[model samples]
Target: MTPHSIVPRYRCWSKKLKTTLYTYPENWRAFKAQIAAQYSGARLKVASSAPAFTFGQTNRTPAFLNNFPLGKVPAFQGDDGFCLFESNAIAHYLSNEALRGSSPQAQSQVIQWVSFADSEIIPPASAWVFPTLGIMQFNKQATEQAKEEIKKVLSVLNQHLNTRTFLVGERVSLADISVACSMLWLYKQVLEPSFRQPYPNVTRWFQTCVNQPQFKAVLGEVKLCEKMAQFDPKKFADMQPKKDTATKKDTPPKKEKAAKEASKPQEKKEKKKEEKKAAPAVEEMDECEAALASEPKAKDPFAHLPKSPFVLDEFKRKYSNEDTLTVAVPHFWEHFDKEGYSIWYGEYKYPEELTMTFMSCNLIMGMFQRLDKLRKNGFASVILFGGNNDSSISGIWVFRGQDLAFTLSDDWQIDYESYSWRKLDPDTEETKTMVKEYFAWEGEFKHVGKPFNTGKCFK
Candidate 1:
C-alpha cells in the first residue's frame, strides 16, 4: 500500500494526545517534526522521555515492532492510535494549512523544494559532514568531490533565493523548515565563511530561516561553522570497538608461565644479562636479513607496457587549469597512442538503485578512490546523468594497455565488477565524440537523453 493511504487525515481526531516521537536525541528528522509542531501549535513529546520507551532497546521490542514494522527512527504514534513513519510525512501531518501551501500550485512548489533538499543537498552534505562527525570513513578524493557538488547545489539555491525570501510563500512554510533542517549539520559543522562566501544569498536565507522564532525554539542559538572540519583518524579509530584479546583454550595458563619465570637460577640471570648485551647485535643482523627476504615481490603492471611520450600529470594540469575544448582536448589527441593504450566506455550495471544525483556522483568518487593505484597509468571522466530517482552513470577511460586497467591489478578491482565495459575503437567517429564530450565535461549525451549533473576525474 502507498504511504499516504496509511497516514490518517489530520481532521479525523477531535481529541489528540501529545504525539510521541521515537528517534535519537540529535536526529535531523526528529528535529524537522519538532519544528513543524511548534509552527502548528501542536503538542509533541519525545518517546524516550515517556516511561514506556527506551532509546535503543525499546524500539526493537515485539510491541514496538507491531506498531512500526520498519523500526526506523523518527517514527510517530499519535494518542489517537494513528501512526506514521518517514520524516517528511510526519512533518506534513504536523503542519497546518498555512505552513503547507495555501494554493494548489504553492503546495506543489513546496513539495518540489522538499524533494530537492533530499535528492540534491543531503547526499553531498552527508558525505562531507558525516566523516567529520565520525559517522563514515573518510577518503580525500570523495571529500573533495562532495565539496564541489555542494557548491553547485548552493549556487542554484542562491540564484532562486535572490528573487524570493522563502522557498514557496511570503512567510515560513514546511518547505523552508524541511530544507533548512536538512542543511543544519552542514551550516553548523562545515559551511564556514570562506567556503560559503560565493553563495551569499544561500547563507543569508539559511541564517534568516534558523533565526525564526519557531526555528530558534527547535534549534537554539545556531552557531555557524568558524572553520571547516576535516576527518580525524584518531576519532575514526576510537569509534571502532576494541577486539577481544583473551587467550584461546589451546594457550597455556598464566600461572604456569609465571611459575616458569620464578624457577630461573640467580647465576643464570647474570649470564643471560651478559648474553642480552650481545643479543642486540645478533637481532639487528637478523632483522636486516629478514627485511631483504620479506620485501614486496609483486611485479608492476605498467612494466610490460612501452613508455610513450604522453605524461599523464602534465595533461591533467592543463585539463584542470585551462580551457578543455581549446587546450586540453587538443593536447590529449596530439599525445594519443593507438597501440600502447586503449579507450573504453563503462556503464553502471544497476541504474535502478541510483536515486540521487549527488549520491551517484559519490559512487563515482568512491570508485576513483579505490582505483588510486591506476593514477599513474590511467585517466577517466565518469559523469552522473539525469535528475533524482532517474539517472545513469557512464564514463570514458584511458588505460596504459589494450586490456582494462582493473584486470592488471587486484587493487583496482574493488568496484569494477559493478560496471559493464566495452573497448571503443579510437579510429571511429563515435569514440572520438565520446572522448571529447566526456573529457571536456560538456556536450549533449543523446544516447542517455539526460543532462550531466556532476562528474569526477581519475588522476
Candidate 2:
C-alpha cells in the first residue's frame, strides 16, 4: 500500500496540525510570515495573544529563552517540534516552490534581492521611517541622507520595474515579498504623495504586490502616508515609562488636616504644651519643612559673572519662529553675551561605542531631559553626526556661568560625565562662527569631519 493509504490516521493528523508564529502584531516581519503561509496553503496560527506570550515580558521567560535564545520576534514552530527564528528564514521555510522560485537561477536572484533589501534599503529606510513613527529620535542630516539614499534605491527599483511586473520574475516570488516588506514602513509612514512622485514605477509595483490576494490577506488595506511626519517631543516622552510617585505609609497627613486640628482650641493648647517640652531643643522644624530645607537650592551660578544686555530666551524665540540663517543667526551675534555667559564645545568621549544614529540622538535627548533644571541658565545646540553604526555627538553649550552649568547642580550631573568639554573664547571670529552654525543647526562642522545629522536644543 502507498504510505498515504497505509497511514491514513497519521497523514490526517499531520495535515490538521498548524504552524504557530510567535510575533507582535503590526510587525512587518510578522506580515512576511503570514503572507508566506497564505501563499503556501499552510495553516498558520498566531501565538501573540497566547496567555504565556506577552511581548518583552513573556519573551524573556525561561521557556521562551529555551526556544529563542536571542529573544527576537517573528519566531516559528511547526507541530512536530521543528522550530525557526528570524523572519526571513521562517518565511522562506513556510513558502511553496513558486514563492521560493522554481529554478536554481531564480532562487539565487530571490536571495540577491532579499540581501539587497536588508543592506541597501533597510538602514536608510529605518533612519527615515522610525523617527516619523516616533520609534527613534530624529536627526535632520541623517534623515536627509536617508532620503537621498532612499531616492537612489527607489530610482534603481523604478528602472528595474519599468517593464516587468515584479522584482525577480513575472510571478510573485520571495524577492517581491522581501523587498515589499522592507519598503512597507517608508510607504506607510514617510512616503507621502509628493515625496514618492519621483518613483512612479516603484509605487505601481508596490501597490500591485500589496493588493494581491495573499498580500492583502496578510496586510489588510494598506494606507499610504498622507504627509511626511515630523518628530514630536511629546510623543517620544509619552513612550517612556512614567515614574511611580505613590506616597509612603509613614508620610504625615496633609497640611489642611493638620491646620484644621491646630484651629481647634483644645488641640492648640495641647500643641503649645508639646512645643514647650521641646523648646529646649531648637524648635523642631515641621517634617515637610525640614525635608524642603534639605533639598538643594537653585542658585544663579552666573551671579558673580558680568551681566550683559542680551536676552537668550528672546533670541531663542526669534531663532525658532524665523529662518535661522537669515534672521536668527544675525540676531544672535548682534546680541550675544560674551562676559555674562560663555560658549563651550562639548564632545562625547566614547564615539566608538556610539552605534545607530537614532540611539545616539537619544543619548543627547536623555542628557537634555536630565538637564531640565538648567533650562533657564543654559542654552545649547548639541548635534549628532554621521550615519548608522558610525557617528559622533558634539554641540555648542551657552551657559549662564563661565564654567559648565552642570557643575552647579547635582541633578544635571548624570549625563555631563560622558562628555569632554572646552571653553570657547567668544571674542574670536571662530567662536562667533561656531555659535552661529551650531545654534542655527547648519554649516559645515570642520572640526568633526562628519556631516551633521540632527540636533537637540537645550533651552
Candidate 3:
C-alpha cells in the first residue's frame, strides 16, 4: 500500500476546491504541488501567457481576464469566486489559514511581513538579478544602481533575521512563503554558493522555506541556470571602438614626453568634446548604456570631512523645523557629521509621485542611515521630508557617526514634522533589553513591527 502523506494541521485548510492555477508552466508547478499534497488535490494547469506583463510574461489570456480582471498570472480562482493575483497571495489563500496563522494577530503579522517581501526584498533582488541574467538589458548605470540598492535592502533583512529564525510571528507565514518563491529562480539560476557567502542568514532562511513540502510541491524538478552575466564593465568594452596600436619606431622622444604631459590635459579636452557629441545620443536613449560602464571607485569622503566641533550644533539650529519639507534636508545632509564619517545619496521611487512623498520617504532613509552610524560610530543620517501631500518623495542621505537617540530627539522630530516618530519606552525593561540586544549587534538591527519610522528612511 502506498503510504499517504499526512498534511500538517496548519496547512490543512482551503480544502475541496476546483482551484485552477492560471500561470506559466515554470511558475505554477510549486503552487500546484503544495495544493495537491495538503489541500484537496488541486490539479496543476498551465495557462498560455505572454512575457513581461509580470516576470517576463506578456499578456494574460482572456480566461485569466474573466477570472481576474487584472489579468495577472499565477492567479487562482476559488470555487466561490475568490479570485486573487500575486503568487504569495494565491499561496496564502490556498495554504493553512491562508498560510498566515489561525489567530488574528498571526494573520496580521503574516500580511505585514509579506508586504515587506514584496516591497523591500523583491525590488532590489529583481533589479540586480534580472539584468545580470540577460533576461533584461545589462545597462551598466542601471545595474550598478540596482546592485547598490539591493545590497542595502539585503543588509536590512540580514540584520533583522540575525537572531530570529522566522519573520513575523514565528513558524512559517506568508512572508517567508512569498520571498522564498520570488527568490527561487535567482538562487537556482544565479545566486551561487560563493555569491551567498555574506548572506548566510538569508541563504539559511531561504533554504528552510523552500524545504517545506508545499514549496517542494510547487517548485518541482527545476534546474539551476548558468552563472548570471557579470555586471562588470569589461564585458561591455566590445560595444566601443578599440584603441589604435602604435609601433615602437614611430614613437618620438619629444613626442613621448609631451604625450605623457599632454595626455592628462588632452584627455580632459577629448572628454569634453565627447560629452558634447554624445549629448544628443543620450537624450534619445531611455536606458543608460555607456554611462560610467566601469567598476565603481571607492572614495574616502570621510577623510577630508571638516572636524569642526560646531557642525552638529549649527545644523540642529539651522533647520530645527521640519514642518515644511524643504531642500534643507539635503542641505543638512551635505553639511552634517563632518570628519570623514558617512555618506548620503538619493533613492528615486518607482512610479514617481510628488515631492512630499519623496520627502517622507527620504526622512525614513535618513533615519536608517543614522542607525548604521550608531553601529560603527562612523556617521549619522539627516533627511529633509519633501514631496506633495499625496505622493511619495524621498532622499537617501547620511551623516558621519552620531548617537541615535540624541540625533532623533524630540526637538528634531518637531522640526522635521515627523508625526510618525515614536520613542522607544525608555523606562520599560523590555525596551532596555531589546536596546541592549541592538547595541550588541553593533547597530545592524531591526525591531520588527515596532521598528522606528523616520518617515524618510527605507527601514
| Best model per lDDT | 1
TM-score, one value per model:
0.57, 0.56, 0.45
lDDT of each: 0.74, 0.72, 0.46
lDDT of 3: 0.46
lDDT of 2 by residue, 173-210 (tens): 88988999989978987899998998899998888888
Each prediction's total of clashing residue pairs, residues at least 3 apart in sequence or on different chains, is 0, 1, 48
RMSD of 3: 16.7
In terms of TM-score, the best-performing candidate is: 1
* Ten contiguous residues minimizing lDDT sum, candidate 1: 283-292
lDDT of 3 at 27: 45
Candidate 1 per-residue lDDT, tens place, 1-459, comes to: 421122112222223577888875557777888988887777888764336554445665788879886455689988888999888999998888877888999999989988888767876776688668654456455567789889998999999999877788777788988999989889978999998999988887888888777777888888898999877767545433334444545457786577557766765887788576544322211111222222344466778778877787677667755777888889988888878888999999999999866567657765765555466578888888877799888889998889988988755676899999999998898988898898866897777788786543233
Clash total of candidate 2: 1
What is the per-residue lDDT of model 3 for residues 269-371, given as tens digits with 9 covering 90 to 100? 9989877765543221111121112113333323343454435434433333221124334444455433433333223343234334433443454344223
Instruction: Arrange candidates by lDDT, descending.
Output: 1, 2, 3
* TM-score, structure 3 vs. true: 0.45
Off by over 4 Å in 3: 1-11, 28-64, 79-82, 221-228, 231-389, 392-459
